[model samples]
Target: GCFWHHHDCYLFKVPATRTAFWLDKIAKNVARDRRDIGRLAEQGWRVLVVWECALRGRKKLNDDELGERLEEWICGGGPCAQIDTQGIGVLDVTSPPYRM
Candidate 1:
């Protein structure tokens, strides 16, 4: 389901089995994601991507911090952004007020 006010929140996952198939599928999914984001942005919607790494493992952020950061982004009026692990670096999609 869609989030409040057209915000699309997706939990991306890639299966370990079928390496070649998964890679191809994931690549297609990434392309679709970019296309969808661009179309949505054209309609004035905001996107916030929360990577799996940001919610688990040794480099994860605490629940409270995550919540705060999400709230800040949603209310802070950022056009597009992503929250990921330090090691994952960041993705710059370039949609104004965008960040990693």
Candidate 2:
């Protein structure tokens, strides 16, 4: 199943020597969510978190449309530039691959 997240929202395809985190009970699993995000960022992955608030107010939105839009955003398509028909700023991302 496809998620509403863009491929580059985090370190999706990097040589990450790490895993993600959860809100609770991580470590027996991984680590705290904020920690994981910060680690990935420190390791040079451009991360973008889509909080619950961003998912709300989309009554007429179709899931597929959002997924496609996300893909475009992660592909360096420019987000903070254009305003959508709904007058909301698109949050596009661009992360340079980390060098060893």
Candidate 3:
């Protein structure tokens, strides 16, 4: 992404299968991310974060089964295609999130 004054910028999100970012729990809001950004800016750095919902919306447009496909994509299986979740939430065993 383009940065302020034409500097380069990069964005990261809550990573799946990431060991480094695991916290005891995610806050009700993004207080953690905001705090990190403040710390980085204090050190003369720029940090960018892309929210899960934003990427999910874009992924939905490209993949027929954005839900299951997103799991495969996250694991480098391929560009997510689609899977029929049948309206099951995270607890559904058949869901990719539960299986993977």
Candidate 4:
């Protein structure tokens, strides 16, 4: 989940051992995700990134709320968006120190 994707959320944590390897691997995963999203978007495919934090956590949204959000985004016809513990919307992927 968030760990492999290197999401800046509560669920992601760099391993104490082999920290360098984990970080490198996670970084590569993040890069690949970005690249894949870009490719899909270029092909006119809508991309929705529902972060794990939004599904399970103290701040997780209820089923109805989550469903409503998904419905809105799907019907709204947005190119790309993300749902996290903070809320549902597009995040600045280019920004450093990414957060949910």
What TM-score fits each model? 0.64, 0.33, 0.28, 0.88
Most accurate candidate by TM-score: 4
Evaluated at residue 2, the lDDT of candidate 3 is 12
Candidate models: Cα lDDT each: 0.57, 0.35, 0.32, 0.79
Higher-ranked by lDDT: 1 or 3: 1
For candidate 4, give the lDDT of residue 82. Answer: 85
**Which ten contiguous residues of candidate 2 have the minimum total lDDT?**
1-10
Residue 2, model 4, lDDT: 73
Highest lDDT: which candidate?
Answer: 4
lDDT of 3 by residue, 14-51 (tens): 44764343322333123444455556656865333322
Candidate 2 wrong stretches, greater than 4 Å: 1-31, 50-60, 77-100
Backbone clashes in model 1, listed as residue pairs: none
Candidate 2 vs candidate 4, TM-score winner = 4
Q: List the candidate 4 regions with Cα displacement exceeding 4 Å.
A: 95-100
Write candidate 1's Cα lDDT for 1-100 as tens digits.
1111111224334446787786675555566667788788889987777766578767677887787777777677467677765422233554322234
Q: Candidate 2, residue 59: CA error in Å?
A: 3.5
For 14-87, candidate 2 gives per-residue lDDT tens digits of: 23343343212222222244355556666866554443322444432356655665565577643232222222
Please write out the lDDT profile of model 4 over residues 1-100, one tens digit for every residue: 7788877888888899999999888888887888888888889998898888889978787898889889988899478888877778874456523443
Could you give the C-alpha RMSD of every candidate to the true structure, in order shown? Answer: 7.5, 12.6, 16.4, 1.7
